[model samples]
Target: MYTLLSGLYKYMFQKDEYCILILGLDNAGKTTFLEQSKTRFHKNYKGMSLSKITTTVGLNIGTVDVGKARLMFWDLGGQEELQSLWDKYYAECHGVIYVIDSTDEERLSESKRAFEKMVTSEALDGVPILVLANKQDVETCLSIPDIKTAFSDCTSKIGRRDCLTQACSALTG
Candidate 1:
């Protein structure tokens, strides 16, 4: 009875916590998305200047509370060298948000390769994936359907894991 009451109390009073990883190729707006989420979900958050935000060499951590849940975001560096370190965090994350530069046609293939590698990792086998086709504010950006089509094979490779692809402008949001 004591254990049951304690569990109930914890569930009712403590916020559920989840860890999410933000990943993408270089200049794909991962950091911008983190900052935008913080600014939108956190009260009194004085976010940094988007223009001043440079390439992330390491990880930038952010936290936000929504409803009864607390979400912790790990925005990792997207450089080719940094990608080797992503698997280290795969076991600890509950979900992944992969950002893509919709306007960069040249890097789409490279991004697809990296994304396929990540999604197929045994450590991340069942994790949910949220692919953000960023830079939608640009006139030349690819549409959501086009982006989906480009990554369809990679998405299929994820097996039974939940995956969603959405269009977004991290800079504007």
Candidate 2:
């Protein structure tokens, strides 16, 4: 009877879960964004120091509960080799957060290529995306307008899915 009651209680209070994927090129601050998000959302969560965080060779998983919904974040490694594995999780993710290093102008093209590929993937069709132009704290960083212009080619591939480009400083967030 106790076990039955416990199960019933859990079922009554279970939160809806949504899986979100964090993707970007290496050194684009994906991990920092994840750490900052966890710290901000989970009152008691003690995320690693931003300076001490290293490249994620595999992935980092974090869960945040807001109201009656639970968000599961998958922070994947962004090295060129690791990018090939991104599609493996596409089918399971409900949303995608693509980070871009605003200070790195040279890599903007490469980032655009990657973004286009991601948006065109059939596995992720119609998945909402949030493109973050990171490093906005830097005086020389690219503005949101610049990032948008650079990625304009991808607009058609993005289809009817919800998408937004916003500037952010993960270190300060």
lDDT of 1 by residue, 16-83 (tens): 88999999998999999999999999789989889999999989999999999999999999999999
Candidate 2 residue-wise lDDT at 91: 98
* Clash pairs for candidate 1: none
The C-alpha stretches of model 1 lying farther than 4 A from their native spots are 1-12
TM-score of each: 0.92, 0.96
Instruction: List CA RMSD, all candidates.
Output: 2.5, 1.3
Model 2 lDDT, full chain set:
0.94
lDDT of 1: 0.94
TM-score of 1: 0.92
